[model samples]
Target chain A: MAQPNPHNTYLPGYKEVGHHEWRTAENSAPYLLPTLQSLAETNPSLTLLDVGAGSGTITTSLAKYIPQGHITAIDLSPDILSRAASHAASVNATNITFQPASVYELAQTFGPAAFDVVHAHQVLCHLDAPVQALAQMLAVVKPGGVVAVREIDMRVWSFHPFSETMRAWVEVQKATHAAAGGSNEAGPSLVAWAMRAGARREDVKASMGTWLYATEEERRVWGTSFRDRIVGGEMRKKALELGIATEAELDRMGEEWQRWMETEDACCGTLHGEILIRKPK
Target chain B: MAQPNPHNTYLPGYKEVGHHEWRTAENSAPYLLPTLQSLAETNPSLTLLDVGAGSGTITTSLAKYIPQGHITAIDLSPDILSRAASHAASVNATNITFQPASVYELAQTFGPAAFDVVHAHQVLCHLDAPVQALAQMLAVVKPGGVVAVREIDMRVWSFHPFSETMRAWVEVQKATHAAAGGSNEAGPSLVAWAMRAGARREDVKASMGTWLYATEEERRVWGTSFRDRIVGGEMRKKALELGIATEAELDRMGEEWQRWMETEDACCGTLHGEILIRKPK
Candidate 1:
C-alpha cells in the first residue's frame, strides 16, 4: 500500500533476505529515543493508536513505558502486523491490540476518542494524503488527547569534504522523496498544517535530529540493502508496472546499490525532527 | 546540519518561522505520536542522550515522558541548540541538560556506559562516517540499553500517471542518492552494520514505516520545495565547485523539480523504516 516494493524492509523478511535496518541503535538514538521519551510524558494512562505499525518495534516499546495503557496498532498489511504481533509476544508485551487497516479507512474502523495518543512514526511521507491522514488522526483522538509525529527533513541537510559522488547521491535521495510524495521539508511543514487545521501554536512542538554513518561499508552495503531489500525493490516493481522506467532503470537501481558496496568512503545522514502536538484540552 | 537548507526558519524576526514548528507538529503527529507510545513500553526511563537536539524536538519529549530520567542533549550548532534550549525553557522542563558537542567527538567527550538509550532519526544517512557515529553511540550506551534508528528507504518509490517529466525527475532523485554516498537500500543495512560490528541479532529490533502525499498540490508544492531548495541547491553548488556537472547539469535540477510539478496527477514519493538494536548486556 505504501510503495509497490513488497520486498522492502518496510515490508517483511527484510533482514533474512540480506536487508539492513539502516544505522543500528547506536546511530539512531539521539533523535529517536529522546523524542520517544517526550511523547511518553503526555498522559499517564495514555491509550495509543499506531497507524501503520510495521513489525511492532515501537509497539513493544509502548507496552514497556505505559504498562497498563491501552494500545491499538494498525497497518494496511496483515502480513506485516502479524510479524509485529509476534514481536510483541517475543517481548512478552500485553495491553496492545493489532489490526489491519488503511489510513483512508481509519475513521470507519476506529471510534471517536478511541485513543489518548494518536501516533504515526515516519508514516506521512509515504502516504498519498498525509495531511488527510493527519486529519483522520485528529478525528480519532480524544479532544484532550495528544497527536505526535516524526519526519526526516532532508531539506535541512549539509555535508563535509563534499564530492561529486555525494552531490549526485543527494539527488537520488530527493528522487526517492519525490516518488513517495514526501517533502524533504516535511518535518517543518507539520506545524503549519496543524495550525491551518485548527491547532494552536502553544500546544505544538517540533524538534530535529539526525543519524550520521561513518563508513562507506556502512553507507553502500547498508544503502544497497535499504534500497533493493527495503525500498528500491518496491520502486522498481512499481515503475516497471507504470512503465515510468525502462528495464535499464530497474537494473540501474540494483546496480547502484552494488556499486556502493564496492566503493569506499563514509556518509552522514541527519533526521530533521518529530513535531508533536497535544490535543486541545 | 541535518539538511542543506532548513527553510531558514531561524531568520531574524521570522514570525513565519513558528510556522515551521507548527506544521511539523500538525503533520508529524499523525505518525510521531504513535512512535513515542510504542517506545514508552520499552525501558522508557532510558538514560537518554539526544544527539543533534536541534530545537529540542526529541530532547523536550524526553523531559516530559521520563521526567525523572536525566538527559544529556548534544548539538554542534549553537544557533539550533539554543533554540532547543529555549523550547525546553518555554515548557519549564528541567530533566534535560543541553550540551554543545559533535557526534564525531561524542566518545571522547563522554565516559563508558554513560547512557542507557541512544536514538537518532534520519541522521545516519547524512554522515561521512555513519558507522563511526554508530560506534560512538555503542560506546556510550550501557550494554543492555537499546539504540534505535529510523531512516528513509527510497527504493520502493513511484509516481503514477507517469510522464517524461516525472521520469527525468526520478532520474535526478536517483542521481542524488548515488552521489551522496547513499543508496535506495540503506535502511536495512543499519542493523547488519551493527551486527557485523560486534552486536548480536537477537539483541536487535528493526521496524519500518512510510509517508505518502495524495494530492498534486501536496506532492508538487511541498515536493518542489525540497527538490529546488536543498537537493538541487546542494548538487548545483557542489557541481559548480567540483566540475562534475556542468552549469548545464546544475541548471537541469531546477527544470526537473519544475517538470514534476507541472505534471498533473496523483504521485507517490518516499517510504521509510526504523532499525532498533541493543548491544549485548
Candidate 2:
C-alpha cells in the first residue's frame, strides 16, 4: 500500500477550483496529444475513450487535431456534459459521443477493450479508488493500446511571500487534504506523488511534469527550492528573457527562505513541486 | 531604457481597470505592507499617509493596528474617495483624515514630511509615469519615515477553474502592460515589480511577493519539480492539504495552455503575483 499523504484530503466546500482556459501552450502539446497520436498512428479507423472529459475541451481539440476519430467521453455532470455536447458541436466535431456517467460505472455501459486509447488529465487524483479506476481503464484499453493521464503536483510552490494570511491559506489547504482520507497527492510533491500513484522510478524520469510558473523569479526560486529540479536556471532565465517574473522578485524570494521555514515542524523550509508521468509498455 | 516590455505597448481601445475583489485571496499584503510595516517600526507613533488610497482597505487595517496614530489618505477619484470617507466614518476611525486630490500633483496639496508612513496598493502600477509617482510618495513621507506600495503582478494567472472563457486572460494583462510601455512584472513577479517603482534593496526583502496555486498538486509539483535540489530525498513534503482546482478542469488545461501561448509578442503566459515595498530610512 502507498503511504498516507496528509495533504491530499478534501474539505466539503474547499476544493481547489479553476476553469479550463488557464492551461498554457507548453502543457497542451504533450499531455493532450501522445495517447491520441499513438492511437492514430496505429488505426485506419479510431474510436476514443475520453474519461472525465470536461466540457469536451479535449474532444474539441481532438476534432481539431484528428478530425477522423470517433469520441465517446464520460462524466457525471449533466451541466458539464450538456456544455461538452455544445462545445463538441461548436468546434464542428460531430464524431463525439458523450455519456453522463462516472468512470466507476462506465465499463458497465461500454464493452471492454473498446477504445484505442483510454485517456484523462488530472482525473485519478480526485477518485477515492484510483488504483481500481486504473484497473478499469486498463480493462478498457485493448492489448497494445495506451492509457494516458495528466496530473499537477501542488507541492511545487516554493516562493510564496510569507504572511499571516499565507499561513492561514496553507492551513486551509492542509485541512482539505486531511478531509480526503489521504487518497490525493497533487500538491507540490509530484515525485513522491508519482510513487504513490503507482508509477515506477523509471517512468517518473520518462514523463517529467511540466509546471507553469508566473515569472522568471518564481521559476528560478522554484528551480532552486523544489525537489525534482527538472527545470530551473535556464528555464527561469528564459522566462526572464520572455518577461515572466522580475529578477528582483526572484532575488527577494531568495531572501525569503526564513518565512516558509518558520514552522516548528523543522521541515517547513521546503514547499511543493510537481511532475508528469506516463506508462510505456 | 528596457525595450518597453513588448507586453506594455498600448492597445487601441483598452482602458485602465482594477479588481476590488480578486477571485483568489491574492495576498497583496507582501507588495504593499512590508514597506509600511518597516516604517511603522521606526516611528513609534505610526502616523500614516495614504496616497491614491482609493477605497482605503489599508487605511482601515492601519487604523485597526495603530489606533493612536493619525491617518491621512488622498485620492483623485472623488467617486472612490467618497466611499473611503463613508467607510472611515462607519468604522468610527475619526483619526483618519481624507482629502480629495490627485497624485500627479501632490506637492501642491499635502505638505512635505506630512506623514511617517506613506502607502498605496494596486495604484502606481497603473499610472503613466510610475517613477515620478514614487518620487511624489517619497516627498510626502518624512526622511526617516516609510513609504509602502503594493500591486497585483497582474501577469501570473491560471484563470481556468476561475473563469474559463478568458482562461488565457493573462493576455489581457500583457496587453495592458504593453500599452503602457511599462515592465510586464505586474503579476506573479510583484517582488521584482516594486523595483520598477524605484525601490531599494533593504526596502525590498521586508517587502515580498506571493503565488497561490489552485491545488495541492500544484504546490507539490512546484516543490518537487522546481524547488528541490540535486541532493534530495524530497527536501520536504508539501501536501495538497487543500483543493484549489478541480480534477476535470485541471485535466483539460493542456489544451488551454496551447491556445494561451499563441498570443502576439505583446501577450503570453499567465501573469499574477504581488509586491510590497518600504521607503528608505
Highest TM-score, which number? 1
The alpha-carbon lDDT assigned to residue B180 of candidate 1 equals 62
- The alpha-carbon root-mean-square deviation between model 2 and the true structure, to one decimal in Å, is 22.0
Report how far off residue B58 is in candidate 2 (Å).
3.1
Which DockQ value does candidate 2 get? Answer: 0.01
Q: Please write out the lDDT profile of model 1 over residues A153-179, one tens digit for every residue.
A: 554333322445445445555555566
- What CAPRI grade goes to candidate 2? incorrect
Q: Give lDDT tens digits, candidate 1, residues B1-281.
A: 13122222211222222322422322322233344445556766657777756567656765566666678888666777788788888988888888887666667788778887776655566554566677777887887676766656554343433456545445555555555665545564565556654666556554444344434556565556645543445544544554455665545556665655564433344444455566677
Q: Fraction of true contacts reproduced, model 1? A: 0.00
Instruction: Please report how far candidate 1 places residue A60 from its true position, in Å.
Output: 1.1
In candidate 1 chain B, where is summed lDDT lowest over 10 consecutive residues?
B6-15
